[model samples]
Target: MTELLPAAGLTLADEILLAERLNEFVQDREAFSDNTWKQLLSVMRTGSRWASEHGRSFLPMSRADLRDYLLWLQASGRASSTVSTHAALISMLHRNAGLVPPNISPLVFRAVKKINRTAVISGERAGQAIPFRIGDLLRLDAQWSGSGRLQQVRDLAFLHVAYATLLRVSELGRLRVRDISRTADGRIVLDVAWTKTIVMTGGLIKALSDLSSQRLTEWITLSGLIAEPDAFLFGPVHRSNRATVALLNPLSTRALEDIFARAWREAGPGKDARPNKNRYRGWSGHSTRVGAAIDMALKKYSTAQIMQEGTWKKPETVMRYIRHVDAHAGAMVDLMDKYASS
Candidate 1:
């Protein structure tokens, strides 16, 4: 194994020391968020399997092997962005281990570039969540009012706040009772202390609509989380064991996604409003955020206004949602009739 060392003059003992330093650096660095950490681990697992099969260590894998891995990923039908992310992750891991990443190789870089160009030319777009429109919210609200169950009340509050605020599921899960305040106008305002975008700018304020405020008040009165300022705003409800409903367990992002899915199924169109029978398929936690952005676009709001409301720093990112709506109802379409008749 000593003969396999690269000609870079790194001794076996120096390699061990490098590994130790990397581990220490990882420990001291701020941790990635839960979802991001999970994604990184998944990418690592795939890369590990490839390295093992090729009888090579990830830290010292050859450029050819990395290029092959990217080709394999593309062949396996991974989205272009996902393939790019896997490449980026491999590069980061190699750098962390104090070695040159294979992605810098011309072969690997050209492979990535070719794949990206192919995706663009083929008109391949990333899959988007089916946004929950304002009408869907009204229907869900009606259903919750008739149910009158503790879980129903909680779901109502969550949906109302989530849609109105357009918060990501992770942010919604992190909401605390103390972060909420009532404005003099009777609206509920959320003091978002942390967000993916606001990590540097500190925090921002989001004012909930009147309907959301009413639902939140009802949820608080029923769930009894109002008494504990530190309690999670959207905690779990033990429907099976009613005694545990008072326990303030923070809901996971997956759980929040489930809530969204179930609500979407119940409120969407279909016979008896059953899951999978509705028009609202492919909806997820991001649906509300997408829907809100499109709604603003339909109301003729400018790009800047939509970006600020959605907390999107990138105009291109915000444009994706606007583009989806524009494809059907943009001003260009409205002008077609005038030109066609001439």
Candidate 2:
């Protein structure tokens, strides 16, 4: 590991002190989830590569070096959020290396602020997944429910459970056969034992709708996952339409996104009473979560209830999904609907 900064002024004793800090950073990484560790390493390599491009090394990077790196990212058309993540991760690396974090500087802060403002002014907003509302689910269920390929049936079930529980794609892919249980009266209850939000606490149990349970049962029966309770619930549906226990590994997050997008698009446009409001494009696994929250809002469910169901840690996050709906139902909209129409 290269020194984070010039060690010219430090004595040998100071080097020993710094070694302790470096050890702490190294040991702490051992506890990160595999996905997290991969991300951190990737970012670190990217930062180093960017530094090499400018004829410098990343470890001893200064605040100015970081600001330049961020500017380069902006110039290369990275999203503001991506720029923010890079800046944050680079800063954390610096801190853990016993150097001052570049993000602590006013210059670095101004650079990030500029990137954010530029994105907003240029309409370079991050695209949110089109909400997969209950109506879309109905249409998709209609289209994909019958004697389809093993993959198609699995996806139908995936979309249903995803919308009902608002589970992130990672959580959905992490689901195990053991996580599912049926009540004596035949109601299906899913125990979500692995979610990013509730990592510190134990998992929560979510109830599936009768329709969703039926779809899932079909997939489980088709895939033959019932025999292996310890295996992951979902796997790649091969060309032969068989997903045996031997073929069991959790679906990759990208694979899950592609699966959701496929089913959502294949179902075609939904039929809503509202004109020009059909959402049939650009759906992702996240659409299920967003759609679930929006549906709950339309049904007049409280924010707390929505958050509880979605396992969202922040009120502001879940509200961002339904704020447009709130705007539409405002007092002015009421006036426009009742008086202006007449």
Best by TM-score: 1
lDDT of model 1, residue 139: 87
lDDT of 2 by residue, 1-342 (tens): 644544234577666766788788888885666666677788888888988878865765777888999999999988898899888888777778776677888999999999999989998755566777899889888888886688889888888888888988888888888889998867689988767667655668999988988999988888888887888888777888787563346778888888876864586454432222233356776888898899999899999999999989899998788888777778888998999779
Q: What's the residue-level lDDT of 71 in candidate 1?
A: 81
Cα misplacement distance, residue 257 of candidate 2 (Å): 2.4
Q: Which number leads on lDDT?
A: 2
Candidate 1 pairs with clashing backbones: none
Note the residue pairs that clash in candidate 2.
none
Candidate 2 residue spans exceeding 4 A from truth: 1-27, 33-35, 246-248, 270-281, 331-342
Candidate 1 lDDT (Cα, 0 to 1): 0.77
Count of steric clashes across candidates, in order: 0, 0
